[model samples]
Target chain A: MTTQTTAQAPARVRLTQLTRGQTARLDSADFKDDSAAHLTAMGLRPSCQLRVCKAGQPCIVHVDGHAGGCRIALSRDLAASLYVLPH
Target chain B: MPPVTLPTNPVSVTVAIRTAALVGNPNVGKSTLFNTLAGLRQKTANFPGTTQEAHLAQVQSPAGPIVLADLPGAYGLSLNTNESRICKGVLTGDQSIKGFPGGKPDAVAIVVDATNVPRNLRLAGEVIALGLPTIVVVTMTDAAARKGIKIDAEKFEAALGCPVVFASGKTGKGVADVLPALARAKVAAGPLSAAHIDEWADAVYAKACTAETRDHDAVTDRLDLAFTHPILGVATFAAIMTGLFWAIFSLATIPMDAIEAGFGWLAGLVSNTLPAGAIRDLLADGVIAGVGGTLVFLPQIVLLFFLIALLEQTGYLARAAFVIDRLLKPFGLPGHAFVPLLSGHACAIPAIMSARAIPDFRQRVATILAIPFMSCSARIPVYVLLTQILFPESTMLQAVAFTGCYVLGAAAGLFTAIIARRTILKGKSPAMALELPRYQWPSLLGATKTAAARGWLFVRKAGTVILAISVILWWLSAYPKPADPDDAQRAAEVSFLGRIGGAVQPVFAPMGADRQLTVGILASFAAREVFVSTMAVQIAGTDDAEGEGVRERLTEATRDDGTKVFTPATSWAMLVFFVLAIQCLPTLVVTAKEAGGWKWAALQAGWMTGVAYVAATIVYGVASAIG
Candidate 1:
């Protein structure tokens, strides 16, 4: 199932590859209840640009423009689930 | 019909003040705070159908009596996983799991870690939006201070328009003042204010917090360099795991030997004291020999739990999870599944229960099914016996082979998960959105306490369920004795159980398991250690020469053809088979209940058994061919 990449593609791709210091914009709808709810609760939305601040095995992404920039660690599976486009 | 005029009486009624549920992300020191308020006066019961316990305690407040329920530490009140669902249900009064059927808490104590204020506040903000009377308890203030971080607690409280408590659970500093304050606080019960947390992010920070410095970036950089390095991170994870396994094997031996010696002594004492009778035979053979045989390995199991608990408490487990997550992603499992899968190495019951962390139903089920494939501690005695018999000449090689069996079990679990995901459990792999709490030194006292408590529970279970089953098995093998006392050995060969074993012999013949082995297999279904005792009993009954002990009886036993029965190849195959098989009834029962019914459990057992049979058959066939 090939799908179009959103502006968050870079961030999502970096997450999938476990590459750090990359940024991307993710489509909110690409997320399921579990992922979406967690992301939304963590303040990561469709238009919000997130930076892959720390990506190793368990990657940490920094959601920019938030109070003191929220940092979240994304497991490889979660990184793959997110559809992102280059920001 | 006209209603008669009633006297207008203003009757005063006392309404019970509803509870305030404390919920938050993991490692926020919420549990410590909960324990402080609840003290030893708390009731610990499993959340319905789940192994996770719901701790309930009632505290008398000046306002009224208030119930304090400490829900599981969860990121959000969203039904992504089983734990989260339980948390959500408890928060919203969903009544999905009826253990907390008294409706939702009147208020919510959103515990936040002051050290990581941003991430913690995110969860706190979400809880506040749930329309519950929210009290934000900023825990770990001491830890934050140690890290050179400071926050204005009262300012944060005013910003959120909720009572905020700066409490240190470790020292009980500032903790005594929280409950009294909560009791006196007015119920701001109304629909939750529509606080768009994202929009007010900067405003909230400016109003609530004051950072001392930008020095955290340097620490973060160093951590990122070490932990997030592709090569270094993987190597560190491998080293950690190797150490874990090595510790499990080496540390367990001393205690395991002690337990075995104690049981052997008890067995000898019982046999010497009691006159030849059914009760003596039952006590010596069934209780002391059978149940005691199983208890001998309890130390190893407890040690394994101790190490795991230490790792978990120290926050190394989350790092391990992250490492495994990266590796397992290609295999269609989320990283969150790693802990559960790792837990499976010790036992599948807890592992299966721990699958509550996996959000997607398909992923969770896959993890659960795969758990039994991990070489659980229950299989250790069987494996040890077989391995000893097989590699009698080489202890080092035997140890290596034992380790190999564990690796093989893990491989099998992974293989099965892949197949199940592609076939029966087909679905998109769930996303793993997890919070990695900062690394902390593990509390030795806490780890010891947890390990002791868990070990005691296990001993209690063995005493009851395992003891009963062993007695029943003894009866099954002992009764309907052969007619001739002079030819007792031949009589046993013709008795009811002997006949049954003989009948089933052909089925396992290909696997090099004869009638005696068949009987051992039957006894193992009750408890795996019974395999050892059953063999001991069989050897004792067949030998005419007076043997001083069970070990000597076993060592001296010969097949009908005058050859040693415990051959290297046969023993190794048996060990391999037991290590892979799902034979424990209690495990099956737990699996059945966890899976929501008996049918799924049956299917799981059937598949595992089939796999064990085929694998054992192949091992035996190849070994015999090579020999």
Candidate 2:
């Protein structure tokens, strides 16, 4: 789940599939409009790089690029909604 | 009539003192800045029709006295939330909103966290779109610098078309510059378009903000790793809550005893100084005793709030909430419910108020509904009395039973929450999305100030209601005095409360509660602890005996049929009843206010009483069958 793409583009996986300490780029989120908007407000916008600090029912992530490297914690359902490509 | 016109204000009327509002995303050090600026000259009031509160204070600036309104933090003013509504209302000068000092604030202070500039800018952009005089305060610049991020103040100000100041609320650096910056605050020539605000903010960040590709605090990462671990995090929460309650109990005892003794002395003085009459009794027992009883809980309330504020300031409470979210989500409650649910052990009035922190309306109501079942400290005396009767000789069994009461009560609360969520309060449980702010040293002064404010609020709101109920209860129990006046038992038999108890006795007869026990139960509706004193008064004619003597007398009391009242079955039933009952009047009043309706309170009382009755009846029947 934390595999690196050696010679090809990174394969997109659900955020929950990433292990702790793995870095991934957010692809897109599959949430209702309000939930998706809230996620974006909290700095989880598509194309931002997220480093998983703790991944599980509630995952702790350090987001960079779109956000100013702020840490956010997302519930399991929310994490599952997020599609990320691991680096 | 055609010539009638209003006179213009005199030139001396002075341009009405400008009003400004502070807006920001949560956990952006906005509160610290407000506290630093406003100091002790602030008042907190709820926005009209909502439990959400805003702080307003007068801040003296070179421009003049600027009235500062601190709006609740919101991620987006357009979001469908109480906080966002209030924020937008105040900014738009909604006359319906009561917290704003002026119709519309003359200026806005948009607070952004330097460490999280882009996300903070999202909110800032939303605020700037209002086209009001605005200033962007970049807080925690020190924290950002520590994380290897830099912000060019001039570039940021140029990009946003407003004044920008870098300030650290903790170290007090650049804080002084904020007041002066407010004087030069300017409105944007044009508002940022809502549709392209994201691109605008991102472009601004790309130009004015720089990062050295640094890890966002390795220490914080390690802390989060352990704090958010499923197993370790839960254990940590358990240990912390256990310690919190233990500290509240142990630390509050000294002050509580002092308050009780002081009130007792005052009551004794009043009784000795006054002539024998209803006035003397009222003063000695009704007003003074009522106020004293309510104030005696101040220490616990203060300590609880103080410690919670400290934990919140240190940024640990969010992690705690994250850890507890999964455990509670299944029951239709959110992680934010943890504080209120846990605080219920100390007292339910404050716990109910704390539920304001819960963002979801359904979850907040569900949490409030379940809080009363947490076995508040008021129920401890009843628990002790019943456990003693159930196992008189074995101290160990009594201890086990006492602990079981708490566990059983918690179980009842959680199950009740689940049932309520599934049926009445059904809605989508929003997925948790809490920001884990960087760990910082907690401010003792800030925590103390918060605790003091909340403690006073409790006294002002709950105190008046509790005192009124106490006086009413006292009047009910003391009236219709017999001709002998000194004949306590005869007076009780003729009193309105006693008569009602006698009538209700038949209803409780199946559970083995006689007229005397029924009277105690009726009186305890005012407070759970009143049961012990009512029984002592009804049986022994003195409600002041030490624990052992009182228990001994109650254990041997006989029913009208000469059967023992404190038999195993009866004692067990009483224990179950006390555990599940909603027996606090002050709690109901508070619940009504905090939950925004009396119907919720009515539902709470009705449901809890029904559950207690049915559960107690079952226990009585089962225990008697076994015997």
Candidate 3:
């Protein structure tokens, strides 16, 4: 169930730009292969809503029950790979 | 994700459940449950030829005693790492698995975190979909209750078409119900399609759980703000690590001394009771010294692992990992490398094994290569001796120099890893994405089990590989029979081992090592601490060594022309040498097993020796200039 905000369609920015406590839906990420598959497997995929738990080099993001109520920590490079769109 | 299929009928169920494999992701209280069920009937075993280990224990159930195999924690069936690969293989009976009583598990139990049902079920659904005779046990009911979460196990079981039991490892709530539930489960005829696994888990959660629509955990929120803060987190991690190392060093001294004294008493008794022959000498020196040398480090290793396990259970480790990611990534390692690197101070063997925590293979290898250079407790005796030889009368100088040795060792290890990443074995650093599990009270039994498992591995290694090496070295020096016991010193000089040492002496002369010091280096291949005892025999004219008074004997001993052998230059060079050298044979053995092969182990030893030699030469050159 992929949802598209027509007005914000081209506004996919990196997750690194997300502010702390701000929730956004992960549209897609530049990552592919194992990196891409890993995010999907961890349930951070298109239309998955995640909140920024902590920001910086190693960032912690919250997928509060929408994906699995888990907090995932991603290195800055990995987080930057994930493109997100604000709600 | 790769989906694995289990055997349609792996075990024949009877009046008693013969075998069951307990599998789950990390932080699911899998070990706690296993410990509660197994009590004291547990033992650790290496999974056959693989470096992976498992805890096997037989627990009495209402039906009968069923042997439970506690597999390593994993996130999914996809084989990204050894831990996950091993779990999938064990559950599916695809590999020739070792350490289990039965060739394959007769039944399987998937532990689902009751508090985090949706996420836990992501794996639970996959396991249930494997068609193995399976039962789902919901744990952390107490923790979930505190969060105002409720799970209806019966409804959850109805949704999954399997048996579900709510159990709390913390309070021993509903633990006895697990075996009976497992006895009733059988491999389903038709497993669910993988495509709808999440939907199935969602459906199960919808039917079986309820919670207040809370935005976040206030406790976790506050803790995270402090623990994940850039400046505060680093300070806290440093403080915690210092406390841990301090505990390991200070607390382990009592047991270390006790072990040393006991081994000394045994050696003395052997010499007193047995006839003075090769047998007596073999038993005393070869068997006792070799095994005893390896075992002496056991207390430090056990304490190191115990503290690590305790910290890991509290969930602070995840935050620490996050905090240290900045430091580790630069060296081509993940943040999780900090624990193993810190633990390397106590001993490198367990630290190498614990490197498995860093999910990436290349990073894990890099961490293993760099670990031995981290000034392990085995190296401390060497550092102290060399530091003393360099600064005999100045205790303050000795302390400062000893601290400098540790700092130098760490810097050298980190740089070595950077070089390793740049040169051979060059590859992309693994992606970093880890779950930060909620902080909880550390499990005491789990910590004990972890310490005991590692401690047992040390003892076993000593029993097999180390014992043989110790005995072999004993024979080499003992034979070529010294013409007279009184001329033992002169006779040893021309003996087989002596010739080997003398042959290598000139090669190492630039670093200022004399023939006797070269022999000490060769002897130390058995263990780093053996350097002291070897020097005592070769130079001090006694077998007793260590901080007690070997400094005087070592500094006073001289060579031809009455030139002082332990000049400040040589002593400084020696300190740098031991700081970088791979002197412990047992460490290489563990490295071989953990790093996947002997080639990596050899590379580690060879590379470290090369580095040690070059660095020691420079130290010698500089010190001689000052002299």
The best candidate by TM-score is: 2
Candidate 1: C-alpha RMSD to true structure equals 7.5
- Please, what is the TM-score per model? 0.79, 0.92, 0.90
Colliding residue pairs in candidate 3: A65-A69
Worst 10 residues of 3 chain B by lDDT: B1-10
Ranked candidates, highest lDDT first: 2, 3, 1
Off by over 4 Å in 3: A1-3, A8-13, A43-46, A66-68, A85-87, B1-17, B48-50, B60-65, B101-104, B189-192, B391-401, B544-550, B560-564, B567-569, B617-627
Top-lDDT structure, candidate number:
2
Worst 10 residues of 2 chain A by lDDT: A1-10
Identify the candidate with maximal DockQ.
2
lDDT of 3 at B498: 79
- For every candidate in turn, the CA RMSD to the true structure comes to 7.5, 6.3, 4.0
Tens-place lDDT digits, model 3, residues B238-346: 8998998898889889999999999999999999999998899999989998888888888988988898899988988888887888877788777888888888888
TM-score: model 2, chain A? 0.84
How much lDDT does candidate 3 score? 0.80
Candidates 1 and 2 compared by lDDT, better number? 2
lDDT of 1 by residue, B410-455 (tens): 8888887888889988877755555545566787766675567567
Model 2 residue B571 CA deviation (Å) reads 2.5
Cα error, candidate 1, residue B196 (Å): 3.6
Collision pairs in model 1: A6-A85, A7-A85, A8-A25, A8-A84, A8-A85, A9-A84, A9-A85, A10-A85, A10-A86
